[model samples]
Target: MVKAAAVVIVVVGALGYYVWDYNTSPTGGKAKSEASASAAAEEAKTHDPEVGDCVKVADPQGEPLPTVVDCNSPQAEYKMGEMLPGTQLECASQYDYGIQYHNSRGFDYTLCFTKV
Candidate 1:
């Protein structure tokens, strides 16, 4: 009988904690769910990191090297190098996103990345 009482008390304490936490947390609000989902959708729509998007490569060697194969703009060509992906790329930090060249460009000129 005493063990049963202890178990009941423990369960009741856990339930009370859950109720208190749910009411106090910011995530408890129904408004945050809709806002979170909308923010997620907007983030998904905006984050399009694709190839052929006019970029300047920021290599460890720094700045554009001499051989830029695909860029039509001299400015874009002037910013090419062996740049890998997910390295915070931009033509410069202030401008829009630069193209992320896939790292498969061998001697024959191709782009490659390990697919997740």
Candidate 2:
């Protein structure tokens, strides 16, 4: 009976120590790591192309430009962000480019690359 009691005590003590150690760890509990990773992943989603970011579009003018989106009006083409790497851009003549559009993703320099 004494031996069994001693074994149980030791096991319980070890378990308690392990729990304490885990909580005291710099990284903290499972919740912290998961939350941090989730937050980082979310931040990564906001990535926009940079100045040297390239992309592939249907640019007939061979005007190597950055990739982007459209979140502007018809006249003012505000710069958004950037595109991917090595993108082919098409002229406004073919794609009917009017205004350079810059959305949250990136900037499209179609302001003066249109035909009409």
TM-score of each: 0.28, 0.34
lDDT of 1 by residue, 58-91 (tens): 4514532222233566635332223344535444
The pairs that clash in candidate 1 are: 104-112
Model 1 TM: 0.28
Model 2 lDDT per residue over 24-92, tens place: 776668657778899998654433333322222334255434333343424322342332222234333
Each prediction's whole-model lDDT (CA): 0.45, 0.46
Give residue 94's error in model 1 in angstroms: 32
lDDT of 2: 0.46
Error of 2 at 45 (Å): 4.2
